[model samples]
Target chain A: MAEKIKPPRIRVSRRIKKNKVFKVKVKFDHPSFTGLAMADDTTEPVFNRAKPVTFIRNMLVYYGDELVSRLSLSSGIADDPLFTFKLKATKEAPVKIVFIDNFGKRWEASKEIKFKG
Target chain B: MVGGLTIPLLSVIPSSNDAHGAVFQTPKDLENLTELERIHLPKISLPPVVEDGASASIVCSVDHPMDEDHYIKSIQIMNFADPIVIKGKFFLTPVNGEAYLSTQIRLSGGEGTVWVIAECNKHGKWAASKKVTVAAGGC
Candidate 1:
């Protein structure tokens, strides 16, 4: 029997205040595909490099329908990719974040925050 | 007789000797005026001076109140002392008489800090309110 595969996950957080700066962090978990190569009777490695495993993570901030900020994470292991960013929000808006891995896989998540008076 | 003698005494005042010396030949021409009256001439109102490493703010007000949809199209903050860019943004909104714009800035690659400058656009002109500086903590 073949083992099941799991998709990546994303997390987001922000302060609940109006017109205040807040920080956001994103993370991704790498999927294990080593067993699949063994079952196929192939010694070829799945990853191009000899590294154990790796994952790619990205962070973005959106205001009202516009992409206000973006940051890219490169050459990091799959343990967990974390990033921190600052933004000032004047109104209550939803922040969307997207994360993608090297295997052409993608995951997305979002968080909505309200500014306090 | 005192008034007649006063005129002769006033005539002894020295005047500028120029080609058109007759233009200012009387004692009245050499009379020293009050300092305030002499200095009160046409002048341009200059903005307040903000020192380096110091903070300042700018404010923009409109004749009429605007709704939440109103936003700042663009903004640019420049350091008058040098050719450094303090902050640049495309969208911002004002609330409670202020719009908070913060920048994660570093001076000559020293330590990273946050420089907060307030700004607003009224009618068609832009103005700044004040500046607030926040030192960098950790990553």
Candidate 2:
């Protein structure tokens, strides 16, 4: 069974204008473990094999049905990683973000891109 | 006697400082790299100048296919003068918007060259460097 994953949170700027660039921020509540660090219980820094390496393997951003951006991630990203990027909002549509962890858990969220008239 | 001798010693040491203005600089002799390796080199974008304490938005990408068998493994952002040169590393895949990343980095040194190095799983490392300076503190 896939691990329990939290829903991804997406935020689009409110003061966006048509044909203008706007910011989109997405945050995921997940642990990105490299599984190379020592366990907290260990006295010395040693590779901990008890836990498996897991991270957000893939992140996709979509404007309505069209794929606008995609980010393939690794354990290099920290836990609860927050990413910010820009998109030119040409129309009012839902900006969706989907994240798939290395363990195959899928999480997603969306926010409407309402441009300022 | 001491002052005169020191002057000659200083002059004998080559000035390693860059004389050119703020600009992104990369190795000129890229012909040595295989055509495929040259294609994997990172293309970095950033402002030439920024406020002393402001963050500089950086975008790096490579014009290469991210195939499963041969893809860009990671993009590393490094500061030439930072005690810890490696700022961050982003691993990518075919789904990663054409192996692109947009983020901001503070040139804590106030003025210096920042580098973005991209590594392909099969092609090794390709790097690009950009120089940024604080307002009024031109490099």
Candidate 3:
């Protein structure tokens, strides 16, 4: 019989963009294991232990091969973490975001928009 | 011989006395009464408050004609958005007849002003000094 390996989960979503400001949120729920332990005389207790987890969130903006801006956020939580900042982008350039989680997990995403003529 | 000596003595001395009596004009006898009066008068001038990226200097003068030593009380720097950045206390040194201070500040923000307050420590009493303001730059 083969054992199953559990993978860490991360959810990244775009929140809002208005007046040249961009905001994004990232969230993660750490994996945990439950075990039984003997305590006192005849009583047993259930112990829940969490695995080690660390994550870093970063947003990178590029114009051609040149990197223009970068913002990074790191946290440990079950809910989403958001970051908001302003960027001056024209129709010719696009912005990219990269989120790296613990256990060597990596996620890459990009967004492109045309300027109003 | 006796007659000539007595005549010479009488001629040298005034008989009843002149119109004005003997006037003493010695350097040691002269007293600084007017100068003493000026020393007790209070004369305190406040310094201008300096904003961030600006330079400010303050000069305080005292009329100590007798060169008496005194202390300054409650020197404060106010109107600072963040007081942690500007360093130093309010006490000053007695130099010449005055105390001079030159403080240069580099603030974090580009706007807002500050006021520098000073007071004289007269024993347990305090004499208030003038307030100076440093204006901020326009955005």
The candidate that achieves the highest DockQ relative to the unseen native structure: 2
DockQ, ranked from best to worst: 2, 1, 3
iRMS, all models: 22.8, 14.3, 33.4
Better of 1 and 2 by DockQ: 2
Q: Write the per-residue lDDT of candidate 2 for residues A3-109, one digit (tens) a residue.
A: 55568777766698886767677767676655453345355432345557766778877788878666656554445556765566667889888888887878889
Q: Highest lDDT: which candidate? A: 2
DockQ-best of 2 and 3: 2
Model 2 chain B: weakest 10-residue lDDT segment is B1-10
| Candidate 3 regions with alpha-carbon error over 4 angstroms | A1-50, A57-59, A76-78, B1-139
Residue-level lDDT tens digits of model 1 in A1-117? 012223323333334476555554444343322111112225433223332433343444465666765434333111332333344656677667665554545666667767654
Give the distance in Å from residue A74's predicted Cα in candidate 3 to where it truly belongs. 3.3
lDDT for position A13 in model 2: 68
lDDT of 2 at A8: 75
Those runs of model 1 whose alpha carbons end farther than 4 Å from true positions after fitting are A1-15, A31-48, A51-53, B1-139
The superposed Cα distance between candidate 3 and the true structure at residue B98, in angstroms, equals 49
Q: Which ten residues in a row have the lowest lDDT in candidate 3 chain B?
A: B1-10
Across B1-139, the per-residue lDDT of candidate 2 in tens digits comes to: 0011110111111112232443422344554645664567677776666564223456676777755588777777776554334546766544343566665444443577777777787767766767766553211
